[model samples]
Target: MLASKSIKMSKEQVSTFPNADELLDRMRKMSEDESLWKKSKTDSGVDIFEGKVSTKYRQFRGVGYVDQPLATMVSVVKDAEKRKQWNEQMMGNEVVEDISEHVKVIHSKFNGGAASNRDFCVFYTDHLSDTEYIDAQTSIIHEKCPVMKGFVRATCLISGTRMIAESPTRTKVFYLGQVDLGGMVPSFVANIVNMKQPLCIARMRDFAMKDAASSSSVPSSASTSPQEEKQNEEK
Candidate 1:
């Protein structure tokens, strides 16, 4: 199981991910640059784009919409453990630190099929406000985190996500990620990452919606556990 430790820090003491604001800006700019993105293979409403970031590496970006509340979408992103449940490529995942409710560090490994298996330790933070747009970013940061001996360490150089409420029950999401695979990767393996973005958003929406339905369907009288019921009877 993933373990977490939290420490309170003053606003000035909190270290922001380096250049996160710039990363978010780049993400927004890329999201609107539809001239670069190509339609994804999936029919799930996500658009995907890929371009060379450097001579040796390429980056991917994706945009999509989900018919779920902003809070539900944010919950999906913050629940790192739940990712392994839906993302087939995620072989192992754990949270190393909970800086606070809005910040965390996670270590995850992925199976790239024929490509080299890769792992990364990333620092993620969420910036949410009622009037300001919801935004988050994940960046490669050095920490005293454990590493899997066998997997190659991939650098999640910088990734940003932005979510905007479209209505009371809908949101627009944009994701940008730049990863260094550490070695040559097959075209097919890369394609899978590019195409999986939309599907991920869709899956999150489905899970959140179903959980909301299940919760709403349960009777309030039966919401308590057996232990709580026994304690109430004793009272």
Candidate 2:
């Protein structure tokens, strides 16, 4: 029915196919696609038989569109709670097997990358906990996240974000800072994360896309290496 689907799409929409499969296959896939919105519409045709089912159906969420902000918020909260449990186990001096249950809670199989960024965070923590854990985590962002390397000044509100205003612009990234120590003691690590809005994302785009070396944003030195900056823009 969708014979004209070959119409050209811009680079962005090109990745997000509105209709990925025929009606029946979509119905079958719905059980596996949690975010899919499956619906049926009446099929009015002159040649339909009485036993026929509704022929027009749709399922979609588009690619590269994981509700980034929503996913960021959800991931932060979910990971934080799980991490809290891990800390508790750590405080109790629990070992590897004990902390693993907490790790599984945060693993995301959604887009299927060799374990996503969040998974990496969980895996690293699995090996490093208690004493070594602190250094491993703080070093992770520096080693893995370019943003943290050049942090000028940052604050973590119970909001699960670090509001950073670099010279060029301000940004509030959800997974950016260390947890505030005030909430739960004796290994209590509660990092807050707020819901992501369109504005929140737009505000950070300047920093993300900026020529980091030139931008005077944030007082600290820049950490984005020449090689990695090139990689980021390709994404």
Candidate 3:
């Protein structure tokens, strides 16, 4: 069985991040391979694939569904300041530069459990295409933000999110990322990446769904600005 599995997976699919369609296609093939290996080892709702992008770097592709509107999901994802609320390992996250309506540079630091904390300064630009799908990607070169001490800056070679509306109120999110976390990675760190990536998707879904529910429950008269909502939550 193992031999047959290996033979089956040898059929190559494009691993490079040339475009969104190619990325999505690669993810589909990865999902199939992962399913064949061991279903029990993977997350229930997320399809995860790992590959080597370079000698010391790895690429990850994750696809998951969120039961929330595309707009709601995108809004939550684009709000970098609020990410720590749901993202498990985000110790610090901030928008370093807002270049335009759809372009900005974000700095984020992550705790690696026992390992040294890792950080990345990324220039991100997001836009809704003609097909109504939201595309967001982090620039490979982000010199606007300074790297912090004690946190090794990661190289986000290719990292982005693609959101497509599967239904009026449901969105299919696809994530593709290739990062080089500086220094040697322990087994625990790799395991954390495998587990935490799926959990991140679950967290985003929960956050967006909860927000949608709360928004729907509020009376139109009580509708308030985001600042008002935040103040109320704090109070």
Candidate 4:
């Protein structure tokens, strides 16, 4: 089972990790720069793009529309406890340290089936607004969570989701992920896995839609007006 540990850190301690603002800026630029991305493929109405990054592994981006309110989608992604509900391979997930409302250090373990299990410790941060929400994360070293036995430590070069409200009941989602599953895995297998990373968007959409439908307290439509959605789309 996954659990969270609360650890209070001063501003100085938080500054030791990579700057969240800088990561957000880089993600925004990469997502917008058409020159950096090439058409990889499209699945289930989502367009996937492949691009080069600093690592040997390629980065992937998926753009699509989800039939759920922006807030519902955001909650689905941000809630660590509910990760296993949508993530098919997730074995465990926990917050190792809470840096702030927008930032935290997380440890996640995955089941690799016949192969050895994999895990990662990442620094996560998110920004939310009425029209758009951006959450970005990169792998980081944390003392509390070290490379554990029986599991390979994977590296998340960069991964996040960018969401824009399109209407009262729809959202435009952009998911970007670049990860190196460090091990003796064959390149062909790795490539195949990387190509399917974008499918996570669809899985998230399905899960969020179901959750929203089941919850009576949650509204089916967002409060954002059509004019507001249009203005956000323009920006």
Candidate 5:
């Protein structure tokens, strides 16, 4: 018997194939090439994010996919442009101009909760930028905003799960397919994806539950995420 730890586990069992080997073969045939997602490549570059986004039908399920909407993604590109303008004006430097130019538009029609707006914003700079980063790090509380000092975050956020982690290119779930995440997935996958250790299924359930809570299909705030909003709220 399987472990009884699963939530809402069904008594009905699933026994496909004659034996273990057959099941393995079936799974193997259905599985995608591991290498396909191994490269940890960025989607379009700037739209390196994929989370839950609303569609014509409002979803209460938290199972949103990342990086799959053209119009929404293009908006993100435009938002990056605005932020770039702001950051450049602040820095008086040509840094952060071309940071998120390749944001892709992943289509998220049936993921349920929201389409995963997945993409990456890699800021691999040279010595000057690195030095400025160190300066900001040293200042800590004194520093205004990290981006103000020429740092671009490579972070991921699930529409429902919230922020996954930072700097870890490609999501682990990007390996296998992700879950439906119910309706309320917590809307924070990007922050959550970068976590060193993976969260148990129970935790994922919680994220999905949160997504179910905020069933409003209304789009979230502008390019700035809920995290950014909270940070601004605190400030």
Candidate 6:
């Protein structure tokens, strides 16, 4: 449990959390080592795997394909507000500090039904390239955010999504999460929840599909009249 304090740190101070490159290296190693994980089940098109780690909570990974470009999928993951709309468990998410254009300190709250609510303060970062996109986050102790009265402070050991561009319209997605939801949560209950965690990838894929559909439905700039384009640009 974290002490109740309202201390704020400078951006330089918060930036000391682990960077994206190091975390990406770890993610690659974990994902590539098949011996460390066992196939759990497949939901929709996503295949879920469960593995043991240093924490009491098991680490789960989901592998699947989404019918959206890497860039579009990246946009969907990066949009924090949009995430809350699809993730029913997410109660709140906000940026606590900006470490860089790609790295940030994020504070997120979750609704733990039948148990106390949970929250986490983590360092979030992402890397995008022509071939692959990686977004990762890990627990971080920030003075600005502490365990509130009604919530338990949870630790996000390591979690994120990795997307590999398969084609202009398709991407291979990998989602991993290892979190310690600190409290008296029973092992059986935790295991059940962890098993379903991978379903989130399917939800994400559906969300991205809808977003792509909506974007495609909008009129392109080329279809707009010169006057309308000028007015849109002016606005």
Per residue, candidate 5 scores C-alpha lDDT tens digits across 97-199 of: 2323321122111111233322122121111121111000000111112322222222211111112212222121211122222223443442343221122
lDDT order, best first, reads 4, 6, 1, 3, 5, 2
User: What Cα-based lDDT does every candidate model obtain?
Assistant: 0.62, 0.24, 0.60, 0.81, 0.25, 0.80
Cα lDDT tens digits, model 4, 1-235, are 0111223555465447888888888887777788888897899778999885434577888888898889888888877666678897998778999989888898989998888999988888888989988988888767788889999987787888898899979998988887777778665666577778888888888888787767867655867888998999999
Could you tell me the TM-score of candidate 4? 0.80
* Tens digit of per-residue lDDT, candidate 6, span 146-168: 66889898777788888899999
Q: For model 4, state the Cα shift of residue 55 in Å.
A: 5.6
Candidate 1 residue-wise lDDT, 1-235, digit = tens? 0111223444443333445455556666666677655543444566666653333334566667877778777777666665555566888766777777755677878996776687877776657764224444553444456556777766565566777788878888777665555545554554456445545666666677777788789889748888988999999
Error of 6 at 3 (Å): 12
Against the true structure, whose lDDT is highest? 4
Give the better candidate number (1 or 5) by lDDT.
1
Per-model TM-score, in order, reads 0.67, 0.16, 0.64, 0.80, 0.17, 0.81
- Model 5 poorest ten-residue lDDT run: 133-142
Candidate 5 segments whose C-alpha is farther than 4 A from its true place: 1-31, 34-97, 103-172, 175-196, 200-205, 216-235
Range of the 10 consecutive residues with the lowest summed lDDT in candidate 6: 1-10
lDDT of model 6, residue 61: 90
Segments of candidate 6 deviating more than 4 angstroms:
1-16, 52-55, 218-235
Query: Once model 2 is optimally superposed onto the true structure by TM-score, how far is the C-alpha of residue 213 displaced, in angstroms?
Result: 10
Q: State which candidate has the highest TM-score.
A: 6
Better structure of 2 and 5 per TM-score: 5
Q: Residues 1-235, candidate 2: write the lDDT tens digits.
A: 1111223435454222222123223323332343433222211111111112211221111111112233232232235453343222221111222223322111111111232111111122222222111101111111122222211112121111222222223222322123222212222212112111112323333323442334446655568877889999999
Q: By TM-score, highest first, what's the ranking? A: 6, 4, 1, 3, 5, 2
Q: Give the TM-score of candidate 3.
A: 0.64
Provide the lDDT at 83 for model 5: 29
Which candidate model has the greater lDDT, 2 or 4? 4
